[model samples]
Target: MPFIRSAGLRGLRATITSLDGDADHYARLGGLDPAALDADDILMPDLAAATTLELAAADLDCPDLGLRVAGHQDLSLLGPLALAIQNAPTVAEALECTSRYLFLHAPAMRLTLEPDPDGVDGVAALRYDVTAPGVAPPPQGTDLCLGSLHRAIRSLIGEDYEPLGVDLPHPPLAPPATYEAFFGAPVRFDRPSALLRFPSRLNDVALTGSDERVRQLALQHLADLSPAEAALVAPTVRSAVDQLLGTGAPEIGAVARMLSLHPRTLQRRLADEGTSFALILDEVRSSVARRYLETTDLPLSQVAGLIGLSEQSALTRASRRWWGQTPLAVRRVAQSQRTVA
Candidate 1:
């Protein structure tokens, strides 16, 4: 099955909640766990995720549901993909990185930059497509992807950056004015693909806060994380645990369900590999907790919640076990190193 990183659905729950709809209900109806959408970088069944978007939009009577979800998210939703893009020195390089590594985000998706097809002067087009077989990209999913892309481009170039034109492969989901107001450009539907036309000169614009070393490191990390061959049981289990963390303490059965394995089978496989579920869960929590402390200014309670702890006390205990210090102390040390560097 073609899979997308769960980050693709980052704002789904929030958008549905904001629209006075039951997000979990839609998720279940679409054959997914509601909590699965909350995790970043874990693989999710692409068609099921897309169907959830379609169902929510149709049932909630919100034609622009995808765009609304996009509004709730930013580049951070892309995880390491965002890291690579933000550190790239120029708009062109950042876009090139995105085109090359988008498969890391969604195996079935494609992003490309091409010359404007209309023979317009000094113009270019950024095209987005989903290459999954047996069906066209659904409208809501397309809207979410394109809306997020538009915002990402604006952030990369300038706040004033607006597409010259927007093209969609399906009929307008809402009034034409709705897309125009959101995109700040004319939108044409029934096009061959989703294309955002912009000034070609903008590609050379230098990005702020870009570090070449950081960009290269992020690219290497992404390359290492990419699914290149048949997956192993432990890494897949680790990913499932990571995905379930924010929902709560991950259970073996739940993890097994995520992997489509019986709990006993999962245990046997782990044992065969000289490990167990508990060990993997601990490693995931420890790694995630450390990363949050070192990289973000999030409160201790929030960090605890993200790593599946119910309270700061649990995190405090875990931090002591892992690092022999409080989470605050870890953050302080990391900050000091960054400042010195």
Candidate 2:
């Protein structure tokens, strides 16, 4: 139930349409509503979005659908995060911004710049990983992510810049040469994670477009949208809530036990961060309810059960509390929005 911002699928519709495949059709098949997705950024189940890319590749008879989709995107796809990255004074700062804020884009994923596994001097590795348990990022989705990362770096530095190599956890979906051509570097598969290797010196190179004022504004926007501590206690507890919500309302004690913490210790840590277990649980439930309502055609009773509500009436009351409307009303509004879009 890990969710990602729908911006993660920025180029999907265009890619599918260009291939003469039905984007809306494929989107629905992958448990998404194309109309609901196109109007605004919303939370999408990470696995569902990844599967859409995978299924689209097969349907379009294009083994490189992921790369093609990535080719259509750049840092701008990240909105405020892109603004922060592009306006940073140095490549290192840009990368740091990404590592810090990419959770805003894909909560299930992680990005890091670390020492190269090969121990190559003057080289570094930019790693991308899907951190959610039991959900492996499919080959197409991995390619899309790495491909976009490579494109974004080139846009930041120079078009001539190339990674020394790329590492992917899965086998090549297209010919190895195809990946090499796209990344402008050697491609290695069956690796531990998706990675881009580049000269360590690149980190220090200054970006000509750097604007301190713009970067600060963008950073402020991101901060206003989410807490700086989102990466730590909040995310761990949120993840646990997402996992346990299907069975029943997740109690803080159960979550604390899962984290090997005493309930009071967990509460204390959350309080230190200016939040509480109750708030996180409510947020996760709200998000899950919205996803099920807008993206799927599940019955109200089923949706209620999935969110750990006792019955349809409980779901209606919860929906009213969360959205200022009943469950059916929420679905109607979503449907109407899609129709208008």
Candidate 3:
């Protein structure tokens, strides 16, 4: 139900020269009527539809096209979030802020940071592919997102700051040149999550444009815009569950506690909406499991733990029920689709 600003759409139109003409045509092609979109924002689904439709209409196939579009966007495109990032003292803190508030920008998607397992001793990463609960991002949206993130970091650190490398879950949608020109580092595909890895030392390096005063003002402005508790409960619960996934199988009571609600209260609330804590937790795990398996390079055992299953065998059983095939089989099918798409 969350929405993205029209800045991205406006940026897209400006960047893609071939799509010139009335904006309504592109909006319509993307499964939306331009008239329906407010001057300020577009429904998230409309944004996704527009993206997919634009790809077909433009006859474009560059995997990094998303990167290009994202790279071209100015800080004005992000508004408050960008203001917060520019004011943060360090790259790490900036990234953390972005990860924490990404739901505001793209509530359906998440951006998580993890230490890179194989990089120069101290490196961290931000994974791509976080999507809305039941919907995947439009095909090129991830590219745009990751590209934008990388560029944002560059703007803070220095334009020449080279990243350690990049990782992507899906195979390339275009030639190697499609990535080489944008990333300026080795790009590995079908690996783990789509990630941008950089030296951990970079985390502490002060951003060039730090302005604590402006950042504080921006933070306050954002805080004022937060939705009420009643509206926040679901996202708060989902976020807490995502954080808890790798620790152990999450319990309803613990999740309730995290939300500062009594277990009974949480149960009654969800039930009133025709669901329950167990269903929500299972749904979250199942959704993330499908995504990690179909997209990321996370191993089954690790993924099992991440999604709250006790062991690999347990994950296998669940996957069988969910997809009617082994997890690996699902990955294989996803891989084949990428190759053929």
Best by TM-score: 3
Put down candidate 1 lDDT per residue, 137-248, tens digits, no spaces.
Answer: 6888999899999998887777757689998866788898999988999998755567899999889988999988988899989889866532458866865686577678
Poorly placed runs, candidate 1 (over 4 Å) = 227-341
Q: Give the Cα-based TM-score of candidate 1 against the true structure.
A: 0.66
Candidate 2: tens digits of C-alpha lDDT, residues 1-341 = 78787877887888788888889998899998786347437888887888788888987889999899889888887889999999999999999898778888877786767778688999999877765532345788889888999899999999547789998876677899999999988898755557899999999999996889999999989988775656468777876787688678889999999899999999999998889999888887787787667645779998888788888998888888887998888778867865673
List residue ranges in candidate 2 displaced over 4 A. 36-40, 131-134, 228-341
Candidate 3 least-lDDT 10 residues: 35-44
For all candidates, the clash counts are 0, 0, 1
lDDT for model 2 comes to 0.82
TM per model?
0.66, 0.68, 0.77
lDDT of 1 at 61: 92
How would the candidate models be sorted by TM-score, starting from the highest? 3, 2, 1
lDDT of 2 at 82: 94
Q: Global lDDT of each model?
A: 0.83, 0.82, 0.69
Candidate 3 whole-model C-alpha lDDT, 0 to 1: 0.69
